[model samples]
Target: MAFAENIKKIFTLPDLRNRILITIGILILIRVFAHIPLPGVDLENLKEFFAKNQIFGLLNMFSGGAMQNFSIIMMGVGPYITASIVMTLLPHVIPQLDALSKEGEAGQRKINQYTRFLTVPLAAFQALAMIKLLSAGGISGQQIITGDFTGGNLIIALITITAGTMLLMWLGEIISENGIGNGVSLIITLGIVAGIPSQVRNTLAVITGEGGVDTGQLLSFVFFA
Candidate 1:
């Protein structure tokens, strides 16, 4: 009915249809990037580590499991998001930034450029911190991060991950300019949705395995949802 008609109407508009297709294509590209792993990672240990740590598990969820895979896109849009937040708050704290924001489209474009520039250092810092955390006997108490932190390997990894974040940010900007939806938000939403099937399977396993049915757990999930 109404939903079907709305969908049909959307497809009937050529521009809208094309935009939707382009968005889907961009999302697929992001997922592909999420599978492209960085070097010097112990994949098996990383997986085991993610399974045991709640904080890492949540981080993996945000990155669409890219962190578990040690993917190049492991940071996802995190640095970009952080940059955006900083920009949003800067206007309140800095009078110059507030004035720049009042300059309309030209002002907004400058602000966006600043955000992009800021994302790089943020991404680098996050990458280094993640490496240190994974290697400091925190993640699964195993050496998931096996590279020499003091050597070129760490530098290379940091550069690769930061570049990955920048690439994702570029893709998101392109999607926002040419495709449907708020591109960055859509990308984040896709990452969250992508992990649902595996979560469902895990829930099923908990019910069918030695634990049997946990009605309280099931109810809590529903309530939380």
Candidate 2:
């Protein structure tokens, strides 16, 4: 009873409750976006395409299926990651960028602005490449546009996906300002953590179908004992 009361006391703190609830709400929104698709491919075809590309599979795993579906948030933090990678690797090769990097808060803000700019091209190119790759892998023949990969549809898709990622980036920033935790990190972490239970359930169902540990133990006893 005392242990229960202590736990209750912790949750009863108003600030903590609000933070916890805010996190939950943000987490729910991220999950909802991850499942939404960008149109053009079926789930089975997308799965096969992912199976062949380890790099993309890893990306999908991190994004919680957003990449496979070409979801609004499909680019996920990939653009941000690419930007960080550039900053990390360039410090040794680029003297000017490196010098600016050491300017404390001012320097960091500059880098962030650069990253946001860099993210645009990175997101667009990656999205276009992914669309082509998915189609080549037999995932879709849908016009990048509705009727064809015409100039219009291509541009539209480019805009749609790019805006999607930018929106996610903006939302993450908002969360950081008005809610709690680093928005981007929390969003990605939530994506992965949110999938864990479903993964476990799927694995468990397979195990149960095969009679799981009980069957394994019986066979072991028959052969060794």
Candidate 3:
């Protein structure tokens, strides 16, 4: 088929092949990072909380189970995304940003630099909020953190998560420079796709009356689907 020939041609070109390989390698690395849990958290309680809370469950799904695992990259480039959105909108409200936006590539780079800087504090804030929320105990009344939530543990977790976000941001930029598509979009897409299998299994369990999934909840899920 013509489509098959085009696909074959893509691999035949050394430059394109290398780019594709690099993208795949980085994606694998990201997924591996997602499995490495952050220290001091009660993973079982965390998983139960996410399972019971629809909102957080959805967020976990979007993060490809990273949130449920409480991984170092649990935030999953979310702060970077927020920072980028803020930067994009600020140009409309702030005269300085508006001027920079009109100056083309160099100006765009400056805005991007600013976005990266903003991501740091945003990530830290979000990390702290999540820590507090989990420690405070959700509807389940079970603390997700096993021990004390303050002091050294809090600081270490905050720094690790913030660093993880920055690392992901850097990886995305690398993909943009060397790979085939928008790096951040690809990372998000990959996360969503990676979550599909578990989602499918859960749906099947609900439909089969397994896992003690309530019939009414299944109906609601079906309606949402």
RMSD of 1: 3.2
Every candidate's lDDT: 0.81, 0.68, 0.84
TM-score-wise, the better of 2 and 3 is 3
Mind giving the per-residue lDDT tens digits that candidate 3 earns over 1-225? 999999999999999999999999999999999999987777887876766565676677678888888899999999999999999999999999999999999999999999999999999999999988888775567667675668998899999999999999999999999987699999998887776555544545555754577554455356535
In candidate 1, list every pair of residues with a backbone clash.
none
Model 1: CA > 4 A from native: 1-6, 148-150, 200-225
Instruction: Give the winner by TM-score.
Output: 3
C-alpha RMSD by candidate, in order: 3.2, 7.3, 2.5
- RMSD in Å for candidate 3, one decimal? 2.5
What's the ranking of the predictions by TM-score, best on top?
3, 1, 2
Q: In candidate 2, what are the lDDT values of residues 66-184, reduced to their tens digit? A: 77666778888778778878877786898888898899899888888888888889889988887666555434443322224437777888888888778778777767776676888
lDDT of 1 by residue, 126-225 (tens): 9989888888877446667676766787888899999999998888887898998688998888887775554444445556778676564344335334
User: Where does candidate 3 have its weakest 10-residue lDDT segment?
Assistant: 215-224
TM-score for each model? 0.86, 0.72, 0.89
User: Model 2 residue 187 lDDT?
Assistant: 77
Q: Pick the candidate with the highest lDDT.
A: 3
